[model samples]
Target: MRLHHRLKEKVLESVSSVLPITVIVLILSITIAPLTPGALILFIFGAVLLILGMGFFTLGVDMSMIPMGEGIGVQMSKSKTILISLAVCLILGILITVAEPDLQVLANQVPAVPNPVLIFTVAAGVGIFLLLAEVRMLFQIPLSYTLVFFYAIIFLMAFCTPDSFVPVSFDSGGVTTGPVTVPFIMALGIGMASVRSDKNSNSDSFGLIALCSIGPVMAVLLLGIFYHPSETVYAPSEIAVIATTKDAAREFLTGIPHYAGEVTTALLPIILLFLVFQLLFRRFHRHQLLKIVSGLVYTYIGLILFLTGVNVGFMPAGQHIGAAIAQSPYKVLLIPIGMLIGYFIVKAEPAVLVLTKQVEEISNGSISQKSIEHSLSIGIALSVGIAMIRILTGISIMWFLIPGYLISLIMTFFVPQIFTGIAFDSGGVASGPMTATFLLPLAMGACEAVGGNILTDAFGIVAMVAMTPLCTIQLLGLSSRLKEHLPPRQPRAKEEVEDCILYFDAED
Candidate 1:
């Protein structure tokens, strides 16, 4: 019954995400130009796959990844051996990040840099930050101070790195933590906090994502110093038309098994680790273990189907549309259009709604889901606008990132601690699979048309999407704090006497 309810909730959230994007596409097609029948069909198919993928991914996290990560966190914390915990965190961080699909996609888009080298460097960054976050939580270190120091290091590295690699470096920070990483990392926080009797256990649970994000930025910045962009041209490709629904469906169906294999490869290591731990710890019963294992299977199947549809049917259309629009006399409209797409795309982000709901529940409704969604939407809108400007003008991403970080760092000191943590975390969550699969390619298309540097101009949409949310969410936090600190109203004399009589009666 619990499993059934969770599945239902996952489906509803996925639908909410996919529906807005579908509506936006429909509006765009009707107003701008009629979409090719093939493109229209592909869009619908992509939406279905995206929602299903989100559902399965969420379920998988709940069943296998979350529990396993949390268990490891608790056990590691109890050891009270700093060296062992640090070693475990570093190794796990690198391994898990290396398998992240979003990061892999982003790496492939970066020109001149070797994919393997980029991947490894980003993974190492995550590992280092994961260790730092764990230590911060265990020792009750303030999140703001660490953020200030680490961001200072990042800014210094930005100056040392080449111009071409700058955007990619910040982008790596955004893409490194997505659907695959969030659930496991959040669960890990819960586990780590379980062992600490401090009043700030919940507070400590909030900043792991913030720290994890820093790892990729710093890693890629260092890489930027070593790597330079080559004079490479990216010519946009024309997508062939699919004549029939059966063709599209058949193509999607056939690729499912392949994706199944891929997701299995991605998930197997974590599953094996969980099983080994379960055997040693014997924490959960046979039935509980079986249920979790079943959930993992559901997640695997869903993800395979989802990825197959997006890559095969949707990506080409997104790129083509962006190129088509950029060549139009109304090319400037791309900014607003991009913002519209971004506003809805975030709704389609699989991990985002999950994070929002969790925040709402954890805060006991002090922070509402609607408020979080609004703040995130505004942030994403600004991000998309900024990305379009970059594509148009070839603006250096560092100019934006340096100021963005400075503002986010300063805000961290003023906002409630939990909001600061969540805001930083939201930066990463807001730019998940949807941004990678669609918006990045859209920017790439625009950059290609304008003869801009793809590495410098087109690459940082994900990072911008990630960065804006930090400021917006903290603003919401500041507002909440203001409300909390407001003085109570004075009672009228009659009302005060009535309250005094009621209090006396209660005491008697």
Candidate 2:
């Protein structure tokens, strides 16, 4: 009965998440960038799948991954063996990240480096950084200092790496904290915080994703130094040709097994890890265990469906729309279009919902979920708009990234510490599989049409989507902080102040 109720709620959330994108696409098609009928049909079908898939995925993660991760964290904290705890976090990080579907999308796109190697490199980076986050939480260190330290290292490495490799490297970081990894690892941080009776432990729980994001950037930059990519080989491909609805239907049908395998591989290790940990600690009782197993089943099925639809239905349309707009007379329109898409697309990200709700709960409604959502949308809109400009003009990604990170990091001192951590984590959550599947392809298509380097110009859309939020959300924190310190609005009116004085005098 509880599951039934949750299912209805999730379905409502999914519709709200997906419906805007559908409407935007429809309006674009009718007015300026009409999709081929078959592609249109595929996109329509994909939207249906996306809504159902997200609904199931949200409910499943709530039931299974959250509990499993928190339980492990609690047990690991109880054990009091630092070495063992570090080892477990390390192993857990690599395992969960290896099969991340977002990472898979990125791995397939990067040239020269083998996909498995890229995956492994990113997985290891995540593990190492997850270890760092755990240590930071255990010691109750300020999250800002850790972020500044690692990001400084990441930027310094960027200067040494090949230009062709920089954007992809940064994007790797953004994609690592995706749907499969975010919930468990984030909950893992929460669980680890259980041992620390400090006031800031909850805030510290959030930065694991932020630190883990940096690892992939550094790892990929190092990989780029070793593996030089040829400039010409990184060109984007022509959009897919879909002659009929039958062809689009076939395209989606063909994609089901590939994503099925990918999502199954992604979920398998997590299931095993949960099982092994449960056996060792017996944290979950029999009824809880049954519920978790049931949730895992939902997660697995939902992911398979979600991935298949996004890759097959969304990618081609996004690319075609980008190419069409790029080739149109008023090509600068890509900026507003990109902005609109970015604004709405983030609302559809599954991990985003998880992060926002957690933030609201953690801050005790001081940080509302609505505020986070709006900040994320606006940040992502600016980022995507900047990305489209980059593609149109062939500007180096460094021009945006260097200043963006510097401003965001500098803002850390001015805002609330919790917002800084949440803002940085928001960067990764906002750039989940949806960005990888649709937005990057859109940029690639536009880059190709504008005669730009797809490698340098096109690839950093994810990084941009990941970046702007750090500044925007922290600015939000700054705004709230100022409001708190504004000296009670100067007593508004003299009469109002006199009434307060009279009340106090009567009490005395």
Candidate 3:
């Protein structure tokens, strides 16, 4: 029954995402005629795999990762030793981030930068900031104040970094918190908060992702200071045509094993840690262990299938469509196309659904899942629109980011604390793998055609994804606040109450 429910949710979310893309593709094919049949087929195939993979990945997170993260959070907090908890948070943050697929994808695209250095720098940033977040939560520090200090550093670093590196730097922060990171981090927050027997435990549980995001920005900024890549970097525009079953099968098979291996490798350390802790502490029940193990299996299979389909099918189509559109007379249509894709893609984001449902459940349905989804859709729409604008124009990312951060920071003061945390985290969670794989490449292809710097113009799709959610989600939060503060119905007069009771009894 549980499996059936999960499957239903996954299908609903995945269909919501793929249906829009399919509609857009049909419109483009009939009216625009830019996307070839082969490209369209591959894109559809890839979207299926991506959606399925996301579903499986999200399910797996529920089964395995969240439990493990929460277990660790509870255990670490129980120790009440600040240094131990801090070290654990730092190490786990770096380790998990090092394996982030989205960050790996971004690093591969930046030609001038060495992939390893970029990966490590981003991982290190996540590590340090994750540690900071845990500490802040433990100490009951003000989230807004920490955000102000760190963002101030990021802005300062932006000035020192070269023009080419700035967008990627901001983007790294967003990409680092993809599907792999969100479940664990969110669970960790919940777990840590559980240990706090305070009235504001829920509020304190919310801002880890916001803080973790700071790590990558600072790390990349520092990287800019040290490693200046002098060569011109451009992302490739050619699309690989997959015409035969052999091609699709071979491509899918090759990637499936690789991702199977990768997901296993990525998850092994956390699993081992969980085992060790379980042995030493004996916290969880036998049934819980069985459930988590089952979840692990689900996660592994889901990741393998997801990666296989995406790498084999989706990527080539994304590039092709973008290139074809760029060459079209109706090229400006890419903005709307991108916006449509972004809106649907949020539904496909594995963590977004989890976060929304969890929020609704946690808040006792004061915040509805429908409301959360609506806000995220609007947020992503704005992000894609802005990203398309960037691709078309050679606007520096800093122009948008500086103002966006300023607004988010100021809003933090006026809103409820829970809203601020969710808003900030939403920035990272909204971007996820879909934006990294499809939207970023779409921007890059546009940049390639217009003869713009790919890194500066195209790379910040993830940043836009990260930034807009801050505004949109907080706006939702503001709306919720308004609803809460609205005056209640005046007490019924004695005659009115008696009349109502009499009417009710008569109806009965």
Best by TM-score: 2
CA lDDT of 174 in candidate 1? 86
Better of 1 and 2 by lDDT: 2
Q: Rate the local accuracy (lDDT) of all candidates.
A: 0.80, 0.87, 0.79
| TM-score, one value per model | 0.91, 0.94, 0.92
lDDT of 2: 0.87
- Across 32-61, the per-residue lDDT of candidate 1 in tens digits comes to 635677777877887788778878777776
Lowest-lDDT window of 10 residues in candidate 1?
229-238
- Give candidate 3's whole-model lDDT: 0.79
Query: lDDT winner among the candidates?
Result: 2
Steric clash count of candidate 1:
0
TM-score for candidate 3:
0.92
Clashes of each: 0, 0, 0
What is the lDDT for 402 in model 2? 91
Pull out the clashing pairs in model 3.
none
RMSD of 1: 5.3
